[model samples]
Each structure stands twice: as C-alpha cells, then as structure tokens.
Target: MNFSYELIEKYKETKGYTQDKQVISDFEEFNSGNMSKIKKGTRHLTANQCIEMANAVGMDQKEALLKLAIEKSKSKEEGKIWSDIVKKISAACIAGILAAASLTGQVVTPHLRYRR
Candidate 1:
C-alpha cells in the first residue's frame, strides 16, 4: 500500500540509503527481489517489516499500523471508516499532549513531538 511505501521511503531517507538494495541488505528478513517488488507496488510488506520501518522513521507504531489498515481497506466505505479513525486517533494524541502541556504550564506547539 501507499502508506507502507511511504514508511519504507522514510526509513530509507533517514538511513541515507541510495538504493532499494541498501534497505534490503539492512533487514535480515528482506531480499533484493522482494524489496524491488515492494518498491514497485507489486508486493506488500509483512507487519514486522512495516513496524521496523515505522521505528526507523521515528513514527508512532500505532499510527503507522492504523495507516496501513486504512490503505488495506477492501471498499471505499471501509476505507472512509478507517480514515476517520486515523483522524480521530491523531487528534486525540495531539489533544492529550496539549492537555498535559497545559497542566505543566508549558506551551505545546503543533510541530512538537508528543513521543520520542
């Protein structure tokens, strides 16, 4: 899915990987053929691979997985439902940060990371 591709791309970008093979080599479970297939959108990554990439890119694992679910929805109606969930999850995370920051007398900004 596109979300998986983005996670993989983000991981590669952060690691300074110049080619798909570099990423393939980095993961013991990955092979050049599969990596190429994934990059070309002919194949999908396993959940573990997605989690690994999410970690490498400093993304929240739950959000990354939710995004993958959104992309994997079987129908437009289902995808819309997933998309709404992701939006609510993201908003809740931000709201929680703001609430905590308020209690601590600190200003929370949109660009700030709640985790990390």
Candidate 2:
C-alpha cells in the first residue's frame, strides 16, 4: 500500500518515465514537497488523487489503485487487514450486482459492465 513503492514500481514499469520528476510531471497536483511527503508516508492522497495516479500510471482499475493508497495509510498488519476488507468489499459488490441482475432476469458480466 505504500504509495512511494507503487509509484516507484510504476515508474519502472512505464517506458521513458525514468525519473521522479517525470512522474511528478504526469501528476496534476503533486509537487516536489508533496512527493517527498508521499514517499516518507507522512502525507496521504485523497480518493480523487488516487484515481488520478491510476490514470497517470495507465492502470485500468481504480479499485486496486485506491487499495494502494489505503495501504499506505496503515501499519503492516493494518495494511493486511485493509486488504482483506477490500477483498470482501469487492466480492460483495460483485455478488450484489449479480443478484440484482438475476432478480431482474438479466445476465451480466461484471467485467463487461466496467470496460476501461
């Protein structure tokens, strides 16, 4: 969940984004000081900021991106607990969607509903 770690990993995964400054340039709001705080785990990103990070990194899923943000805000054990909660939430969301579809006599694929 550490944003610095995820951001660093994304920097490595993305082609031609080889520097922290380059990554900062992709961010709409992050500055050098904010980046430093994020790296040091002293600052937290908001939900919208997390979504922006996901888009900047070309990640397709905001849920996973937000999970990283959440993880950065907690201790190791707390992060693990948070992950479990996320899993449960994700599962419940899917189940609810499926149940709703079934009640309405519709068959829907979860992935198909949220493309891109």
Candidate 3:
C-alpha cells in the first residue's frame, strides 16, 4: 500500500475525521465529493496532493511525507536513477568486501608473524 494512503487513513481514524465533509473542510484544496471517494478507496491521491493533505492536517513529520511523495512521484527515469544508485552502492560494497578479504589473506600464520 502507498505510505501516504496509510498515513492519511491512520490520521483520519485516530483524529475522528471520518466524515467526508469534515475532511473536505479541513483540506479545502480538494473537492468535497472526492474526499469520500478517496476514503472509500474509489479514488487515490497523487504524491503532491497527499503532501498537501498532510500539511492541512497539521502533521509535523513533513520529512516523512516528503520522502513518500518523492517515492510516489518517481517517473520511469527517476526509477532508473534509483536503480543505478542501488547498483553503484552494491558494487562499492562488493569491492570493499573483496579488498578486506585480500588483506586478510595476506596475514601470516601465528608462527610466521611476530606478536607484540
């Protein structure tokens, strides 16, 4: 499930903002009827809309919402960028592990190396 959706639902349920009219009033940027549809799962929010909703609801954790929006709004090219980043990180980790192993391999046995 989308993190933004989960967060919205959690907030609405916890804060007793279950009514469509109330939600619409609280988040005035959205259409009145759409609030009910969104709550009913018949409609969904885009990343930007979700962030706006979160802001309207006075959620203090803006960074979390922003990250979710970034993730949700990713285009195909953005996804490729994330994938490339993951690949680069994985390559670096592998290289680090190989370097560590090579260094360990060069360690002399206890009898061959002097101990302090």
Worst 10 residues of 1 by lDDT: 107-116
The TM-scores, one per candidate, come to 0.75, 0.54, 0.40
Q: What is the per-residue lDDT of model 1 for residues 1-116, given as tens digits with 9 covering 90 to 100? A: 47767788888899998788888887898898887776677677777888888888898888788877777778899999999988897799999999999999798457756876
Give the runs in model 1 whose Cα sits over 4 Å from its true position: 107-116
Between candidates 2 and 3, the lDDT winner = 2
Q: lDDT per residue, candidate 3, 1-116, as tens digits?
A: 55555666765775688755655565546675665565565566655666665665666544444445445444877756655665676699888988887788954456667789
For candidate 2, lDDT tens digit of each residue in 3-116? 655755575466466667876676678688887777777776656666655666776555756476565645778777777887898899999999999999797656556668
Query: Ten residues in a row with the worst lDDT in model 3?
Result: 61-70
Runs with alpha carbons beyond 4 Å of true place in candidate 3? 36-62, 74-116
lDDT of all predictions: 0.81, 0.68, 0.61
Q: Top model by lDDT, which number?
A: 1
What is the TM-score of candidate 3? 0.40
TM-score: the better of candidates 1 and 2: 1
Could you arrange the candidates by TM-score from highest to lowest?
Answer: 1, 2, 3
Q: For model 2, where is the 10-residue window of minimal lDDT?
A: 3-12
